[model samples]
Target: MTSDGDDTTVLSTEEGWQTIQATIHDARGAMYTAGSTAILLMWAGIISIAYLAQYAISTFASDFAEQYPWFPGPLWAALTLPGVIGSMTIGHRAGRSLSTGAAMQSVGIRVFLYWMAVVTAAGLLPGAAGLWNETRAETIPYVLVGVIALGHVLFGILHRPVIAVFGLGYAVSFYVPHYIFEGIAPAVSGIAMLALLAATFVWVHRTGEW
Candidate 1:
């Protein structure tokens, strides 16, 4: 009878541990979903505004562009700076709330560093390949779009399948505008991305699948 009781106690303890582990797993998943939602929404707003501003500058502010000669580059950096800060802030807070907080923080840092490397490589490739001429300048935006889309796809494959879907959608939106409506490609792509991001945000909230 004592041996049987001991066996029962061991099973109960094991079950309790499993339950605790499941709870932690669920909490971490929730935190990740919430953080990703906020980050995606933030980027949606930033990208939309940045693209619109680029269109306005290129179309209506030629004088300013000529005066600066480096108008959009600085503008984009300025616009995205907030998103970078916000992402780090969100990740930090999310990490603090989880049992695996340190590991979560490490993952966030690694992800940020990965993106930094990707963007740096993209920026350097044209120069390294001797393709940084005036004509090639026109393709820079398209190249950036491709790079961003690729990043999204890769990130999604690694972390979230839905993000991969959004990435493909984003690429298609930009490509359609560029090919079919060259005159307003930037504006159209910006609006389309905004809509897509917004829709994804809504779906995630509604389904609670993130």
Candidate 2:
């Protein structure tokens, strides 16, 4: 950044990078809020459909578990599919250029979806196949932190502040799941999530970047 009386100086490469990051940080907030809303809508639709499916089975169905076990109810509530899609949509709109929006955001969001799809497929596999191996789910954060966290840094390398903000959301996703799923405690999990989000919100506000 340079200064000339009453005239803004053009940013050099490094300063331009900072400017891009600030823009992305603003964009991420919009994306998350939009994504959350989309996911809630998806939850409503999924629950409604799942309930109807169960009703049909109850009314005229037979051996439902033998054929249609592993209802998508809990999966619907998990909210990853819709959330990831919604986030991706926002990311498309958030892109700095077509390259970032089309190539990067699209691929990143699809990576998340692919991950979930694979997990679901595994559950559908023959033999002792289901997602509830406590030990397996326990490793989710580690896998994500190792892979997704690195993905964040690599893809968002140009946008430091944006990645930092998104990282907060990502980290909270990991920690909250442990309390909510492993501990089977919602109250504690909710508080932890809210507290961390609030702190991040305050920090963002103080920074006045977004």
Candidate 3:
């Protein structure tokens, strides 16, 4: 009963609404992405600054020890560990889905592993000096194993057990030369950690888990 021109007009109106809805949806998605990225980057940066400050203060004491026959305190700079896992886990769970929650759970497991194997041990470092000097090969391996274990757990190829094994291997292989070799250890560790994170990001994107 409708004229041809009337049908055409009705179809055009429907298409316009569909287009508008799509545009709005796209805009919302972009906004969320931008906002999340900014917040995480800022949070991570702040955490990094805090970690560095602690490291610097720790360095001051250790340096004094160097001149006065002192030694690094029982602390090996622990501030960096908390925010590394804490902020990312918080960011992931903010408005994400069940899978992200699960990944973060695994991350938490790794962190617990670090705490048991590293932070607690860091507290007991003073006692270790009595057993062996820092310059000895024995102590270096222990430090590397603990710190590398932390890296593997916090930044894994997946939220699976394989990453933990790899991390353990890395810890075993770390030598003092690497730790003090022109300050490359820190950079290398950072990159390796990022590799795991990069993989996680890919997984999140491909699966739409984020």
Candidate 4:
């Protein structure tokens, strides 16, 4: 039913599609598996501990600080230092082991850099907010939730649907509480994020997905 030209065009299109699909498969397969998962879990654990420690200091340290003047600063450094060192080590190892095509490697490195930027911005927001006022400080949690949701959506578009769906759920879980009660948003968001990361670690570990 088709002419020679039409058949040729169809064949070319199919070949193009096949090439794209193959690249996608290879890219996914090349992602760091156990290494990425371990890094994620370690970071999640560290963040969780830091958040809990911060909460404890804010809520209870007033009384304890008199008796233990050196506690808060030392504790925060202890919690944060290991995470920094571990993440760098794991990321270096993963980079060394990566066997993806140049294009995929470039994409992965950009994504990693973007995330690092996000983290740096998130870290600075609190200090910036302090310079403004308490109300501005309160918005940090909401901004972080939005950023996380957006990050997930970007991942979905670029990588996987599962991450996108998880991001949607994460955004919802934290945002809903803000509408209900603002007082608990930071704590709730931090806890929820850590829980989601924990669950994601388990899922990726079981599935061997990145």
Task: Estimate every model's Cα lDDT from 0 to 1.
Answer: 0.68, 0.43, 0.43, 0.59
Write one digit per residue (lDDT tens) for candidate 1, span 68-163: 655666777798788778877765565554445577666555545555555556556655755555345445566766776777788778667887
Model 3 per-residue lDDT tens digits across residues 52-169: 3333443557665455332333233344445446544544454343235554345334434433454445435535656335444224324534554564455444333444554554
Which pairs clash in model 2? none
lDDT of 4 by residue, 1-210 (tens): 356657643447778899999997865645523144454456446655665565566567757755665454466458757766675666555655674456544544544554555555655665565622433533444554466467656755665666677667667766775677666765776677677777877887789765
Cα lDDT of candidate 2 equals 0.43
Model 2: per-residue Cα lDDT over 63-102, one tens digit each: 7643544433354345445644554554345332334445
- Which scores greater on TM-score, model 1 or model 2? 1
Q: What is the TM-score of each candidate against the true structure?
A: 0.74, 0.36, 0.34, 0.61
TM-score of 3: 0.34
Looking at candidate 4, the ten consecutive residues that score lowest on lDDT are 131-140
Model number with the top lDDT: 1
lDDT, candidate 1, equals 0.68
Give candidate 4 misplaced runs (Cα > 4 Å).
Answer: 1-21, 28-46, 64-84, 100-111, 126-139, 181-189
On lDDT, who's better, 3 or 4?
4
Model 1, position 12, has a per-residue lDDT of: 69
User: Candidate 4, 73: how far from true, in Å?
Assistant: 9.6
